[model samples]
Target: MFDSSKRQIGFAPPSIDNECIAAVERVLRSGWITSGPELKAFENDLETYLKSPRVLCFSSWTTACELALRWFGVGPGDDVLIPAMTYAATANIVLHCGARPVMVDIDPIERVVTLEKLQAAWTPQTKAVMPVDLGGWPVDYKAIGNWLNSAPIRERFQATSAVQETFGRPLFISDAAHSFGAHIENMPVGTQADITGFSFHAVKNLTTAEGGALSFSLPSSLDLEQTTAWFRSMSLHGQSKSALEKTQSGTWQYDVVEAGYKCNMTDIQAAIGRSQLRNYPDHLNRRKEIAAQYTKALETVPWCTLPVLKDATRESAYHLFSIRINRFQSAQRDALMARLKEDGIATNVHFIPLPLLSLHRNRGEHMRHYPESEACFNEQLSLPIHLHLDDEDVTWIVERLCYHVGELMTPHA
Candidate 1:
């Protein structure tokens, strides 16, 4: 039923250029494509750009999340709190580490975990709170940090200190896969949480084919350099020297400190990342402009409920332009998507609430427990928002959406 003649707009895709291609070519010709100088340069640039104290590149955000859990010693008896409205990876990492993932509801408008929700879920077994930056919007890091630092929270941690001392004080690990350049209170997402992970997958604003990074905000008592070194070791099969380090003269001798995962980012991937990072500010500006255009174009549509972007102290990276079809049933939502597909305009749902998924449900989570998340999942749709989309593309997608809204709302189809 789809026609190639009608322009096809993808949901999200990488915005590659000659510079990115050249960067990859350079890595390929250097004879050091795996975990070498390019990775080092990329990590340094990322730290400088984000103003974070440390950054550790990885193969994927999921791996980074798992490593963060391991670093915090979250396993077996520990419980980690996560927002119910996030992608599965946010909770999956907890399960990967043998910890329980306690689901909490997000603010309906903001789509982020709130202080009240977090506090209600906090228990003696709760070792960490993971807040997902939904659709590139920065969660209220200040509020969450303040709550964790509060007297009551401190007292709880102190009371359980003997049992949970290894977990290292109710840590805040941010799942910021969509918010690489996002900022809150003049602080970048990288440094906002005690530990934050950023994704650079093909669909993300910063495309690195497939890669991610973890930034740290270690406690005063902990040595930042030592912590980063530990993470570096864990990411490379627990070896004293990485492939890059061993390649140097007289440096071939190394040791394996512990059993660790092979999740280090290669120079080939980092090459693309370095090029993207250099041009990230311009790309981000274009995204912000596109978001503004979409906001203005879709404002008058009664069926649409747009994302809130009025936080004076923070700004999203504008990863996904998600809108809800207000008052629409799940059937109507599906119908709208089908109609859009028939018109050759591609669209997607940002997520289906984790609890509603088969895997999580099989693990004993009920849909009724996350009412708001279910409501959002039933109506939410993601529109295309990438640096490659121009004004014409934005106009075309909005036109199709308005047309489909009318078709679905008619008394009889």
Candidate 2:
């Protein structure tokens, strides 16, 4: 137990320390800040960490993934399969590309979209599929991949651009924003998808404050060097030469190849990410411990349905400790959260299903269509699981949760 006045446990706060500050200070003193050597080095480090062939950093996941949509030519009249349970960015990016986000319902237990749902939703106009790893639990990537490569499905794919025509199949882009360090079959999440985008927002496990990265494992038909250059150039207004390249003597002149978006990661951000990556494995371990503590304490509770952290083939990154209060509707769940807040503890819901949002609703998407997503949303409660917490804090949170839930479920005056 904690003194309410003295304890204020924030939900998913950034775990910045003296070392992280020092790294930023060094970058600040370096004089060159934007998209320079530090960014390149960070990408290389991420490549090694993720076991990816190559990785690229950008301002955020939305931009990096939207660029992928643009690069793959996902425009109007095309359909991109996505889960209704994901964050807005997943569907918003599809809409930004002038394509329809064919939202699919999640599996009741997995809380992630399945190959069957995607297959059922597929159409000749479906140009791509962007599945999210909701709450760090990866969707069935192998099953989805096998489906994409099946001869019957491949024959139905309609290629509207050169990039699409090359593979003769719909693109598989993973919305791995919350699953950066998660694994499937002992392999990291990045290599499984054709292109996997990772978010490094302040709350993420391996944050760059406000940054994201993409790891590519595109089909061999595409030229890696050329594709890498395309993304790099696009991130910087489609310029023929980078600021670093033009710094060479008598290399000032350059050409603008195409109108592009400006969403490059700066050196300062990279410095923070580099510092964090050095001890990421240890950070991951501590997070796992915290998750285990919660699971061990609550697994026996009749009303609690603990989130899956590991199984035979997949392991979560432990980004969020989202547990379900069985049979609790939105009102009771919110009341439990209120009780936790009164104790100076913070909690959150991972997301409101896409269909429930005004933007998606106006677009003709309805919450009723995604029964599993709505049901999951009603009971989902994401407990604080950050490095800022120690064993005692976790135990305290569990105690408060148990008490509040019991009170809510009990009949009282």
Candidate 3:
């Protein structure tokens, strides 16, 4: 048995090094640490990497989601569909705008908001469908787009629908916080949906301490420049010019265009983001290798269920290597976690289904209908899978996990 006093493996830690430190130092020395040149360079690099026309950085993913909803006109009386298993931020943004969040069950296999669930949940008030790329797996965007483009179905479902009638069509706003580099059919995640938001939290594949970005695929009828300008204004307290703009020579003039929230990413964060973006492809490859190793190590266990892998046309960023303990009760799952802790291995759960939480439950969201999410919550565990983990660490983690499973499977003590 492993000693509990030994140095414990961390679940996930920011993989920052000299590059990130140097970038931060440069920002501090530049005297333009706020949203300035570094922010612009980061945004440009992100746009090029994601192959999108526009990308706007924000302080966090929550703010990005809220701003996307606001700019896309998802406001009072609107209904935004989201997965029941995702982080609360996905639905909280909809609520922040006075809109209703219509929770949908995820696909059991993929653990993501699927087209079938979205179609089933479509209602007269449905304004937008937000599909979360859960655990870095990209959702089926082509299927969603095809469903939305069906003329007969759109006419039947779109007309008289509150959100659709108000916006002229149902919008697809993706919560892609977990999937910065994921792709589907060779198309990047950010550009798959009409509007997509990416998270660059410290624990993500790409880190900026804390940041997010929004990208869009504008409709032919909408003006991209105008939309981008409107979102930029909304991000900066609805002011025509930001602090950086006012500091420029002879540019000390601006106007308050509207009442909006303040949530802009500063140059200090963007400086780190630029370096991370440059190395993201390699980071993704390493993550994929780790995931493959986990699968190879754990698949033989009869009680283990591996995370979904990429098929012919879909690919994942491998952000999380989640495994479910088949036939394990909630108590058994808890015991396994405790045993892993004793063995100096760290583990985590991706999320607790939103409906089970006190805030949501108090708001009348019951957990009885979200069986898939509940089942996953009871049995799933996220293993360590970051750049920080080495081969020996991964092997030790797998061995400890297997030992615990073997113990749980034995006859009552």
Candidate 4:
């Protein structure tokens, strides 16, 4: 049933309420806007949300990841395993750190890296592995942790940083841009990995317009305060004093202890994030509710294979509601999306596997070895699942989708 009213259905969009607007306004009127109190409070709020020791906000998740790798001493001649079924940023950070990214395949069902695949991809040079939490569905860290605990793998780890020396194993970094506010087996995502990076991109479940944050979970043997300070310095051009600290009366002295990247979050962005965090529980719940609505309507559609929403072991943030049409090829998938566009609906694909991208392909990453990733790319489609979508919007999107799917699935007579 095509929309008769010319109603337009968009993909995910940010929810900017009046409260979010006022938050930005407050920051603007504060005079001192850059890296001020708002950003500090937002980091504190994120620290509380993740229940992790340290939370450092950044300009983007990409920088947050690169900085983490750098802090852990991942550099030239090292290898970092990244999931093939994810946005390039997951692997790109490894490249930016001057480490070779070993693109690995994922489990077909979960659309995320698994222990078996990781084991097969591991090499003596492997320094770390960044597991991605695709579409907000939490990765099974318990299984992954078991894989890391083995003596054989642990012995291969080369400790570079003071903190890495404590772990005695390759770092497990979670590229959890989609999984913020997500939990696995009752534990939050930030607690599941050695380091976790979250996205607050404009299109994410929670937006700071364009910002991200990192959470730390070092072994108890390491000093949390010392390590947190080190990361803060690394994000601010390795300066001894932050802009906020330097502003204090008669305290303008600072030094560039080491070369570092500039990736600090802005106060304006933090203000929006702070507002979003204030009602995060409700925001997260609304996303879950919308996911339930989609699942109930599309469950019986044979061609549609819904993404992993939640189970006993994990609860997703529901950032994206991606579906795999069981019988559709890439050509058919494109045609269905085109049909929906004609009906005033906008749809999109979650990702094109890294091996399929030119950067990785030129680096000798071949798609032939990643059959599961290729299969996912050919059939997957992301439907609208933001809080902005009302019941009518969702109902219409599903109806239009089913109609297009039927037309494509039916044998040409």
lDDT of 1: 0.86
- Residue-pair clashes per candidate: 0, 0, 0, 0
Evaluate model 3: give its lDDT. Answer: 0.85
lDDT of 2 by residue, 79-178 (tens): 9999999899999899998999999999888888999999999999999989999889999899999899899989888888999989799999999999
lDDT of 1 at 154: 70
Q: Give residue 139's error in model 2 in angstroms.
A: 1.1
Candidate 3 similarity to native, TM-score: 0.95
Candidate lDDT scores, in order, read 0.86, 0.92, 0.85, 0.87
**TM-score for each model:** 0.96, 0.98, 0.95, 0.97
Candidate 4 Cα misplacement greater than 4 A, ranges: 1-4
lDDT order of candidates, best first?
2, 4, 1, 3
Give every collision pair in model 4: none
Error of 1 at 131 (Å): 0.7
Off by over 4 Å in 2: 1-5
| Model 2: lDDT of residue 178 | 97
- Sorting all predicted structures by TM-score, with the top scorer first, yields 2, 4, 1, 3
lDDT of 4 by residue, 150-263 (tens): 798888777777757787888888899999889876777897788888999998988998999989887787788888788888889999899999989999999997898899
Model 4 lDDT, residue 320, Cα: 88
Give a tens-digit lDDT track for model 1, residues 359-410: 8999999889888888888889988888768788888788888988887888
